[model samples]
Every structure is written in structure tokens, then in C-alpha cells.
Target: MTYSASANRYDTMAYRRSGQSGLKLPAISLGLWHNFGGIDTFERGREMIRRAFDLGITHFDLANNYGPPAGSAETTFGGILKADFLPYRDEMIISTKAGYYMWPGPYGEWGSKKSLVSSLDQSLKRMGLDYVDIYYHHRPDPNTPLEETMAALDLIVRQGKALYVGLSNYSPEQTREASRILKRLGTPCLIHQPQYSMLARGPEAGLLDVLDEEGIGSIVFSPLAKGILTDRYLNGIAPDSRAAGPSAFLNPDELTEETLDKVRALNAMAGERGQKLSQMALAWVLRGGRVTSALIGASRVSQIDDAVEALRGLEFTSEELARIEAILA
Candidate 1:
């Protein structure tokens, strides 16, 4: 069947400016980090993408080393783009990152100009796109000179391979330095992708402040703490859960009794607010306007629906915020 986007897609999801840049991303963007891989069912992954667009999720985030086999997610997404999203390219924001361990040997990863440029070329080929909306350095490379990495990003922009550049997993100091270098090169750092959630408050300590000071928007990943903040684990881990998988990032041991108790309390609070635990978790991340988007990974179409519902109860009073803090404490 032909996929026609919903007419009211633009009416529901909120769009926030990417820093002071011209780009305005949907408040809830879809991330192809987990489920959209070669090992996963192609049809199911395709369905999630279609459903996300119908719900006004215009931004799709990806990375070079996303899939289990690495780069397979981009291949999957490329086929879908050629099939479904090609016509609406102008309406969507697609981003992919380099850095991290992509391949073996020295040049396969990190912040070298050769690695960054070559990785993006491969990504563009796999995704079947001439250019990506935002290209990111997947992480900061301590050994590589910041000037080289930032210059490589600026060169990609100048060469028309990417519209804007971003940084991910960078510390506050690293971000400030990278932003300074990019700005000097006539390409300001547009956005930062950080691991931020109620459970993971590392960014809150200082990363968010640097972004505000530098005018860089943030789209937080793992807003649900790898599904811990969701109801998926409320009754204990299912066999098919990520925690139960062999290569799972979320280990079963992490689900200690104390953690579960906190989760249950948070779930109760969410129930009082007429929301599911997952919905409230997402809303909590976007409560303050500091975060431009909550980048969510969904295994099924229903998960996407739950995430969209989060927008309805995004507001949190001081009391609710304090209550959440106490629970975290």
C-alpha cells in the first residue's frame, strides 16, 4: 500500500528552534539507534518510520555505529527513505554521526579528519541521501586536535555534504571548546546530543548550561533510561526485553530492588497525573524549554503513540518537580 502522510501531522507535534539556527525540529524526534537494524524485521522498522511521520516526527537521528553490525540501520533507513520519505525530504530533518568505534584499526574511528570525512561519505551512500541535515561528531576525541575535527565538520558543510554540525557525548569543557572552534570557522555548533534523563542527570550538572551559554540546542537521548523509566520493567523483565538480550545495553542486574522501588514511585506519580510511566518520563525531560527535543527509540508503532501522548502533560508544577526530585533522591 502507498503511504500517504497524515494531513494534520503538522498540527499536533511542537517544533522548537535548534539553538538560534533556522532549523526547527519536532519536540519528539525518532531515533534509529536500536530497533531499525538489519537483524530486525524490515517491515516493522519501516512501519515505525511511517507512523512517526504521520505523528509529525520530522526529525530522524542516526549514527554511523548504530546497528548491531554497524551502519546497517542507515542501510535500512535508506531503503525506507527511497520508498516512503523521498518526496517529503524538504519537510524532514535527517542527522547522522561519526566518531566511536566504527571499524577496526586507527582510521576507522575517532576525530581524525580522514575518519570523519570518510565515515560520512559511507553514511551518505548507505542512507541514499545527497546530504544530511545535521552531521555530528559522535564523541569527543582527546587525542585529535579540536581544530582538525571542527574544520572537517565545517568543510563538510561548505562542500554541501551536511547542512549543520553537532557534537554528542562531549563534556561541558569539550563542548565549549568545540563550539568556539566551529564559530571561528564560520560554522557555529548547531546542536548537542547528550544522554539525559531523570535517571541520568550528568548533563544537568553543566552540559545544559554550556549549551545555553553558547546558544546550542540539545536533543536528549535515552530520555527513558533504556526503558527503565517505562512500564516495560514494572513487573520484571520479559524474555524479549532489551535487558534479557545477549548484547543488551541495559543489563538485568541494573534492575535492583531499590531501582525498581524508585521506578514504582515514579509510576505512581505518573498515574496520578493520568499518564503512563513512559509518557511522564518523556514529558519530564522536556518540561523545561532547555531541551529542544526528546529523541526516542521505539520498537513498535504503539511506543511511538505513547511518546506522542507525552506532549499533552509536558507541564510540571513546582510541587510535581519537587516530588520527582525527592523520589530520585
Candidate 2:
């Protein structure tokens, strides 16, 4: 199906602003970090992108290193873009990242200008696009000079390869430093993609405020905490859950007795709100204005449908907030 065909349904989901920029990202954006990988058939990956657009999700996040075989996710997604979403390319915000391992060699990864610039060109070629809506440095590299990375990002925007620049997995201090450098280069970092969830409050440690002050938007990844904050693990690990996946990001060790107890309490709180744990988790992230969007992943259409439904009642009482904090406490 094409975007014009899906345009009617696309207006159903709310679109939030990206930092101080003119771009407004869908409340629920799809990420190609996992299921839409080389491990799956291209048809399966394309189907997810089509379904997402039909469900009003217009922002697609990807990286050069997403597929199990590195570049295959972009290649697969590029096919879908050409066949289906190409007509609505201007209507969509497609993002890709660098700064992670993509190829073999000493210069293949990290924050160097050589890596970021070359990786983005390869990413665009793989995605069959001339320019991405936003280009990101996947993560901060301690070894590479910060100025080099910022300069590379600025170069992309100036060269019209990427309209905006962003950083991911950056600490508050690193974000501030990058912001200053990007400003000096006159490209200004547009957003920060951090992992935030009811279970992971690391962003609250200071990153949110840093982004806010610098006028950088935040679109949080794993807002469901890799499905841990979802109902999938409330009782026990499901046979098909991430706990069963290959990612070290969510290990069995993380499911400590204390963590499970917290999950149980959170589930009870969800019941009081008349929402599932996953729905509640998504809503919790939207409660604050600082979060521009929640980057989510799904194995099935039902998960996307449920996340959309949660947005219908995205509000919590002060008492409920206190109770949630008490549970997490």
C-alpha cells in the first residue's frame, strides 16, 4: 500500500514537536533496531512499515548497524520506501544513525568525521535516499574528539545529506558539550534519543533538563523497558518475549526478585488506571512534556494497536502519580 492510501488513518495519532524545531514527530514512532532486521524476510519487514503507517506512525528510526548482518535492515527498509512510502517521503521523517560498529577496521566505527560522514553516505545509499530527515550519532565515543563528531554532523546538514542532527545514548554532560559545538558549527543538535522507562529513570538523573535547556528534543527508546514494563513479563517470562531474545540489553539477570516485585506492584497500579502495564508505561512517558515521542518496537500488529489505544487516555491524577512513585520507590 502507498502513503496517500494510508494518509487518512495517519492523522489519528497525535504528533508532538521535536525540540524547538518545526518538525512534529508521531507520538509513536517505529524503530528498525530489532524485528525489522536481516533475521526476518524483507516482506515481513515491509509489512511492519506498512502497518505502522496505516496506524498513523510516520517516523521511522533506523541505523547503519541495525540488521544482524549490519546493513540489511536499511536495504530492506529502502525497498519499502521505494515501493510504498516514497510518495510520502516529504510527509515522513526518516532517521538513521552512525557511531556504532558497522564494518571491519579501526576507522569503521565511532565519532570520527570519516566514520560519521562515510556511514551516512552508505546509509543513504542503502536506504536509496538523497537526504535523511535526521541523522544521529548512535552513541558517544570517548576516544574520538567531540569536535570531530560535531563537525561531521554539521557537514551533513550543510551538504544537504541530513536536515537535522541528533545524538543517542549521550550523557547530560556529553549532550551539553555536543550542543555547544553544534551551535558553533551553526547546525544545532536537534534531538537526543535516550532509553527511558518507568523501570529506568536514568534520564531523570539530568539528561531531560539538559535537553530542555539546549532546545534539543528527546524521543525515548525502550520506553517499555524492552517490554519488561509491559504485561508480557508481569506473571513470568513469556515464551516469545525479549527475555527469550538474543539481546544482552535485557538479560535474565536483570529480572531479579526485587525487579519482579516492582513489576507486580506496577501491574497492580495499571489495573487501578484501567490500563495494561504496557499501555500504562507508554502513557507514563507521555505524561511529561519533555518527551517528544516514544520509540517502540512490536512483534505483532496487536502491540501497535494497544499502544495507540493507551494514548486515548494519556492522563494520570496527582494521587496516581504519587502511588506510581511509591511503587517504584
Candidate 3:
């Protein structure tokens, strides 16, 4: 069956500008970090993508090292793009990153000019994209010269490979330095993606402030703390859940009784506000408008639905915010 996007897609969804750039990403964007790999069901990922676009989610985030086997997520996304989204291509914001451990040996990863350039070339090939809307250095390289890394990004933009550049997992200082270098190269940084959720407040210490200073928008990943912020583990880790998987980042040990207590309190508050824990968490991250988007990962189409439904009640009273802080405290 041919996939026709919903006519009402843009009517109900929210879009926020990516920093000082003209690009406005959906307040809720989809991240292909998990569950869209070659090992996963292709039909499942396709349905999720279709539903997301129908719900006005225009930004799709990916990277070369996203899949379990690495690079397969882009391949899966490319297959879907070619099949269902080619006509709507101009309406989407597709971003991919390099800098993680991809292949082996020196040129396979990190921030070297050779590494960054070669990685983006391979990423473009995998995703079947002539150019991504935003390209990022997945992480800062300790040894590589900052100039060389930023220069590689500028070169890619000049070559028409990526429209804008970004950074992920970079510290406040690193971001400032990288932004300065990129600006000097004539391509300013557009966005920064950091791991921030109610459970992970490390960004609050300083990263968000730096992004504001740099005029860089942020789309935070793991805003749900790898599903902990969701109701998926309120009782216990289900067999099908990520926590139970061997490669899972959220192991059962991390589910301390202390943490579950906080989860239960938060869940109760969310109930009082007529939203699910996941929905409230999404709203919490988007609160104050400092963050541009909440990058969510969904294994099912309904998860995506719940995320968009969160926008319906994004506001939080000062009392509610204070109570939340007390609970986390």
C-alpha cells in the first residue's frame, strides 16, 4: 500500500527553532538509536517512522554506530526513506553523527579530519542521502586538533554534504571551543544533543547554559533515562524490556529501590495531572523552552503517539515543578 502522510500532520504539532538557525525541529523528534536496526523487524520500524511523520515529527536522528552491529540503523532508515518518504524529503530534517568507535584501527573513529570525513561519506552512503540536514561530531576527540575536526565539518558543508553541523556528548568548554572554530570556518554550530532527563540532571550543571551562550539549540536524548522515566519498569523489568537484555545499558541493578521510590512518586504526580509517567517526563524535559526538542526512541507506534500527546499538556505549575524537585532531591 502507498503511504500518504496525514493532512493534519502539522496542524497539532509544535516546532521550535534550532538555536539561531532558521531550521525549526519538531518539539518531539524521533531518534533511531534503538529498535530500528537490521536485527529488528523492518516493518515495525517502518510503521513507527510513518506514524511519526503523520504526527508532524520532521526530525529523524541517526548515527553510524547506532545499530547493534553498527551502521545497520542507517541502512534500515534508508530503505524506508527510499520506499515511503522520498516525496516528503524536503519536509524532513535528517541528521547523523560520527566520532564514536565505528570500525577498527585509527581512521575508523574519533575527531581526525580523515576519520570524520570518511565516516560522513560512509554514513551518507548507508542512509542513501545526498546530504543530511545536520551532521554532528558524536563526541569530542581528546587527541585530535580541534581545528582539524571542525575543518572537516566545514569541508563537508562546503562540499554540500551536510547543511549544518552539531555536537553530541561534548562538555560546556568543548562546545564553546568547537563552536568558535566552526564559526571561524564559516559554518556555525546549529544544535547540541546531550543526555538529559529528570534522572540525569548533569546537563543542568552547565551544558544547557553553554548552549544558550553559543546560541545552539539542544535536542536531548535519553530524556526518559533509557526507559526508566517511563512506566516500563514501575513494577519490575519485563522479560521483553531493554533492562533484561544482556547488552542493555539499563541493567536491573540500576533499578535500586531508592530509584523506584522516586519513580512511584513521580508516577503518582503524573496521574494527578492526567498524564502518563512517560508523557509527563517528556513534558518536563521540554519545560522552560530551553531545550528545543526531546529525542525519543519508540519500539511501538503507540509510544510515539503517547509522546506527541504529551504536547497537549506541556505546562507545569510552579508548585508542580517544586514538588518534582523535592521528589528528585
Candidate 4:
């Protein structure tokens, strides 16, 4: 597909299929979870999104409460859609979620039919789109029945508000329950987004198996482990790194001596492979066919270039894999 000058860089990025689905997603996707809020300059955010698209990142992920004040990320993204991406909507895959606390009272969050339905409408209004490529539950809600959430997803698809449904942060059992309900409703659950990286192997515990059995795709967020697996922390936390940011997701203290030792050892292995620690970490996640793509965040274009370069050195020898496992041990 052809795009404007700002989007011409897409030819450099690789695209991977979402499980058995006919749709293919860029091997790496841009996320609006950070730095694309109402407070951030819309021009910069637009440039980043445009650059990502140019680099073949067709999928953009967002949620109702992505901004610091809530809803601002969606609002900002909506403006970008109207200003630049609306004309090329067919070339993009947009996704938004609803299962988080956004407003007062009980109807604001969770997987209830009322909450999911209302949040989706609000998301479409904020994005100024007729339909999002994917709509997610955001997070599983124990208080709401699984059927209610699945039914709500079914209604969303039927209403043309979203083409496919996704679930985020749901455990293996919860995913199974929701998948069963969605299957019964005839709305196939297409993807599951979770936090997965070499440092965080929680998904490999059982989530991957469940997805394989159910024929559902997996997209991993924080696949770089919030930059911990990167060489940035090997020398200690940088002044402007996420570890120094106010966000609670990444902490400087978590840079324990043990973890740092592991990071150094992993860096040595990456050096032998002629790749950066960050690139190798990302490539590691994509090594298994079970992963569809790695959802990543970046503060600069150079980081984007470096991360994308990792795709060229994704291969690893069996011995190399064993050495990496031993280091993690």
C-alpha cells in the first residue's frame, strides 16, 4: 500500500500474521499508553504515529484510561485520526479497551455489558471512527460474569463498532471462560495482549498453551521489560530513562544487584551475537511462533530505528538459547 512521505518508511518493518487469522500485523506496533496524552504536544504524537505507520507499524493500541488524567490519550489520538489518519483508515488497525476504572458508580468499569457497551461507544466517539479493528476487555473483571463481557463483545462486533474482539491481562482460566462464551456467541476472540518479555516469563507458564489450544493470537506489551533487558541499565539507570520517570510501572530500585548481573551476562551474550541487548530481548520474544507481535513504546525515533534493526538478527543457535537460559538461571 502507498502512503504519504511521512508513512513511506513502512517498507523496512516486518509483518506477522495473528495466529491463523487472515489479517497480518506489523511485527512491532506503536502504543499510546505513554507520551500521547492530552498534555503532550499533539504535533509530536502525530509525527510518531506517522513515523510508525511509515515504518510498517499498522497496529496502534489504546485504552479508555490511557492518559494521566484519563481519556486524554484517546482524545489526542482522535485528533490525529481526524487530521492525518482518517483518509487511510483502511490501512490501519486500531484497538481500544474498556475494562478499567474510568468514571464514578459501578457502570464505569469492569466487564459488565453496561460498562463494555458504554466504553466502546465513548471510544468510537473519541477516535472519530466508525469501527476499530479490535476492541478489548482491557482487563478481566472478577465481579462481572464472563458471559456478560462476551455478550457485550458480541454486540460490539454486530453493531460494527469493532471488527474483532480481544482480551488483556486475563489469566489462562479467565481467557478460556471468555473464549468459550465468545465462541458460543459466534464472535471469535481474535487476540490476547499481555506483558511478556525475557525478564517477565509469566505468559509462558500456561497462557501460551491456552492460546494455542484455542487458536487465539498473542500480542505482548512491555516486551523489553520496561527497558530493563536493554543495555541502558547495564551501566546504571540513566537520568531520563523510564526508571527515573514518575510512573510506577518501572522502578529504579528493581535494578537489584542480581538483576544487574543478569543484565550484564545477557549483554555479553548479545555482543557475541552482534546485537544489542534490547534487540536480542525483542527477538527472543518473537522467536516462538506463538507471539504475533511486540507492542512497544519509544520516546525517540532513534530508539525506533535500533529496535527495528533487531529484526535482522532474530535468529539464535540452539546453544545460544541454552546459554541465555543459563544466564537467566
Candidate 5:
């Protein structure tokens, strides 16, 4: 059977501008950080992709080292894109990143022009695309010059390997400096990917302010704290849950009673708003529009549905905000 997108796909989901730039991203973008890998079920991943697109999720985020073996996520995504999403290519925003260890050699990783350029070439090949909508330096290379990394990103845009450039996991000062360099290079930074949630508020300290000042947008990842903010663990971790899996990204130790308590309080509050805790978490990060999008990782199709439903209740009352702050505090 042929797959056709929902006729009303754009009717519900909201789009936000990427900083002062003309580009806008879906408020609920999908990230291929976990499920769309070689080790996962191809059909299941394909279904999620199809459902996400049907729900107005126009942005799909990927990275060079996203898979268990690294690079497999892009391969899987490429296959799916070729099979089902080719007709909608122009309507989608495909983004990927580098800056992690991909191979044994020193040149295989980091922020050098060589590493970035080579990694992106490999990424483009894996995704089967001539150029990504956005390419990011996944992290700041402590040993490499900021100018080198930003210039490499600019080169990617110039070479048409990427339409826009961005940064991820960069600190306030680092982002400000890199933004200046990219501006001088005549390619302004498009967006920033940060790990942000009620559980992880590191960006609130300064990163968001820098992005606001620089007129850059942010698409926050792990907005549910790797499912901690969801109902998945309200009772206990299931055998299929990431917490019970071999992956160290989320472990049993992370679901401490203290953390669960906060989650429970927040979950109750979400109920008051007729939302799941996960939906409220996504909305909270996007509350003031300081954050442009919330990048969600869905292991199942229903999860994608739940995430899109979050946009309906994005606005929160002052009392709701105060109660949330009190609970988190």
C-alpha cells in the first residue's frame, strides 16, 4: 500500500522561527537519537516517521554517532526517506551533527575542519541527501579553535552540504564566541540544540539568554529527561523501558525516589491541565517561546501521537508556573 500524509497535517502543529532567520521549525520536531537505528525494527521506525510527518512534525534531527554502532541511524533514516518521504522532502527540515568519536583515528572526531567536513560527507552519504537543512557541531571541541569549527560549518553551507549551520551543547561564552565567528564568516548560526527539561535546567542559567541576545533559536532535546518525566516509570520500569535496557543514557539509578517524587507531583499537575507529564514537560520548555522547539525521541507510534498533542496545551497560567517552580525547587 502506498503511504500518503494526512491532509490536515499542518492544521494543528505550530511552527516557530529559528531566531531572527527566516527559517521556521515545527514546535515538536522528532529526533532520531534512539529508535531509528540499525539495531531497531525497521518497520516500526518507519511507522513512527510516517506518523510524525502526518502529525506536522516537519523537522527530523539526526547525528553521525546516533546509532549503537554509529552511523546506522542515518542509514535507516535514508532508507525510509527514500521509501516514503521523498515527495515531501522540500517540506521537511533534516538536520544532523558531528563532533563525537566516530572512528579510531584522531581526525575522525572533534571540531577540526577536516573532521567536520569528512563527517558531514559521510553523513550526507548515509542520509542519501545532497545537503541537510541544518548541520551542527555536536559539541565544543576543547582542543580545537572555535574559529576552526565555525569556519568548517560555514564551509558546509558554502559547499551546499548544508543549508544552515548550528551548534549543540555549547556553553554561553562558547556560543556567543562561535556566533560572532559565524557572523564574520557571513553565515549566521541558525539554531542551538541543548539538553533541557525540568530535570535538566542547565540552559536556564545562561545559554537561553545568550541565544536570545544573539537572535538564535533553540531546539531542546531530552525535554522529558529520557522518559523520566513521563508516565512510563510512575509505577516501575518495564522490561522494555530504556531504564531497563543496556544503554547507560538512562539507568535504574536515575529514577531515584526523590526524582520520581518530583515527577509524581508534576504528573498530578499535568492531570490538572489534562495533559500527560511528558506533554507538560514539553510545553514548559516551550512556554515563553525562548525555546523554539522540543526535540522528542519516540520508541512507539503512540508516543509520537502523545507528543504532538502537547502543542494543544502549551500555554500555562501564572499559578501553574508558580506551582511548577515550587515543585521543581
Candidate 6:
């Protein structure tokens, strides 16, 4: 069956400029970090991708180490792209990253030119694409020189393997230096990917400021805090939940009584705002104009619908903001 995208797909969704770059990302993008791998059903993953595209989610994020067996998510995504998304390639922004133990040996990971370049080539082949819209260094390598990593990114752009370069999980100081080096190399940093949500406020302290200062945009990941802010855990965790599964990212122990109490309180506030807990959580992340997009992970098509509805309640009054801060504090 041929997949024809919704005619009004671009009508309702909001697109925001990524910092000072010409690229504009959808306010809500999808991440394939989990549940789109070899371990999961291919049909379900394909349906999620189709549903997301129908809802105007133009960006899909990936990384080298995303799957359980590593790199399987890209393979799965590649298959989907080949089948349904190939026709819409120009209308979408695809991104993938490298860093963090991809292979067994020392050279398999980290920020070396070899690691970053080779990993991206492999990612391109796995995804069956000529070039990715954005390529990211998954994390900062403490031991690798910033010049080498930034140069590798510059080289990628020059090689036409990637159109723009970004950084992920980098601190304020690290971002500043990398942005400086990239600027010197004539490849200005386009955006930054970081973990930011109600539960994770580390970015609020100084990371956002740095991005603003450097003229770099931010697309936040884990905006729901691994489903902690959603109603899925309002009751006890389901046996099939990610927490109950074999995911190292989300564990059953993370759902502490204290966390649940906070989530319940937040859920109540969301009700007052006429939104679901997940919707409110996503809106909260994008409340301020600082964040360019909220990168979400979905196991099902309905999760994408819920996230799109979040755009409706993005604005909040001062009182609501204060109350949310108080609850989080």
C-alpha cells in the first residue's frame, strides 16, 4: 500500500528556528532511542513512524548506540525510510549521533576523528541515506581534544555527509569551546541536544544561558523524564512498561514514592490547566522561548497524538509557572 501523507500535515504544527541557523525544527520531534529496534515489532515501529509523519513531525533523531544490540534502531528506521519515507525525504530532517561505546575496542567509541567519521559513515549506510540533515557528537569525550572532534564535524560537512553539526550532552563550558572552534573552522554549531525536563533541571542553571550567548539552539530530550511525568505510572507500573522491561535507561527503582507523589501533584496542576500530565509536562519544557524543540520517544502512535496536543497549552501565566516551580522544588 502506498502511504500518502496528510494534505494538512503542515497546517497546525509549529516550527521554530534552531538558534541563529536557517533550519527550523518542529516544536515536537521524535526520537528512536527505544522501542524501534530489532527487539521490538517492526510493524509497530513502522506504524509509529507513519503516524508521526502524518501529524507533522518532520524530524527523527537517532544515535549509534540506541538499540539493545546497538545500531539496530537505525537499521529498523532504514527499512521504514526505504519503504514509506523515501518520497518525503526532502520534507524531513533526520539526525544521528556517535559517541559512547558503540563497538568493543577503544577506537569504537569517543571523540576521535576516526570514531566520529567512521561511525557516521556506518550510520549513513545503516539508514540508506546519502546524507543526514544533522550529525551530533553524542557526548563530550573528556580525553579527546575539542579541536579534533570539531574538526571531524567540519570535515563531515565539507564531505557532504551532513548538512549541519550539533552537540549533545555537553556542559555549558564545553559547548562554548566547541562552538568557538566550529566557528573558527567556518562551521558554526547549529544546535545542542540536552536532557531537560521538570525532573531534570540541570540545563536551567547555565546550559540554556550558554546556548543563548553562543547563538545556538536547543532541542531537549527526555522532556517527560522517562515517562515519570506521564499518567502511565499514576497507578502501579504495568508489567509491560519500559521500567518493567530490560531497559538500562529506565528502571523500576526510579519510581520512588516521593517521585510518584510529586508526579501526582503535577498531574493535578495539569488537570487545572485542562491538559494531561504528559501534555502539561511537554508544554512546561517549551513554556519559555529558549528551547527550540522537545524531542520525545514514543512506543505507540497515540503517544505522538498526546505530544502534539501539548502545543495547545504551551503558554502559562506567572502563577502557574510559580506553582510548578514550587512543586518541583
In model 3, which runs have C-alpha deviations exceeding 4 angstroms? none
TM-score of each: 0.98, 0.95, 0.98, 0.95, 0.98, 0.99
- What's model 5's overall lDDT? 0.92
Least well predicted 10-residue stretch by lDDT in candidate 4? 1-10
lDDT by residue (1-329, candidate 4, tens digit) is: 33364535566778877866778888888888887886567888887887777777889999999875589899999988888776778989999999889999989988899999899888888888888999999998877778888999999999988999999999999998888889899998999999998889999889999999988999999998888888888888888875676554577788899999999999988998899898999899999567999888877766777778888988888998999999998
Candidate 1: where is the Cα deviation over 4 Å?
A: none
What candidate 5 gets wrong by more than 4 Å, as runs, is none
Clash number for each model: 0, 0, 0, 5, 0, 0
Q: Write the per-residue lDDT of candidate 6 for residues 263-293, one digit (tens) a residue.
A: 9999999999999999999998898789999
Clashing residue pairs found in predicted model 6: none
Tell me the alpha-carbon RMSD of every candidate: 0.9, 1.6, 0.9, 2.2, 0.9, 0.8
Q: Which runs of model 6 end up more than 4 angstroms from their true locations? A: none
List the global CA lDDT of all models: 0.94, 0.87, 0.93, 0.86, 0.92, 0.94
Candidate 4, lDDT over the whole model = 0.86
- Tens digit per residue, CA lDDT, model 2, 68-140: 6788889888988988877778878899999888888987899999999899999999999999999999999
lDDT tens digits, residue span 212-319, model 3 = 998999999999989998889999899997677644558678789999999999999999999999999999999989999999999899999999999998999999
lDDT of 6: 0.94
- Show the colliding residue pairs in model 3: none
lDDT tens readout by residue for model 1, 42-126: 9999999999999999999999998866999999999999899888999999999999999999999999999999999999999
User: Considering only N, C-alpha and C atoms within 3 Å, which residue pairs clash in candidate 5?
Assistant: none
- Model 5, 271-304: lDDT tens digits are 9899999999999999988999999999899999
lDDT for 102 in candidate 2 is 86
Which model, 2 or 3, shows the larger lDDT?
3
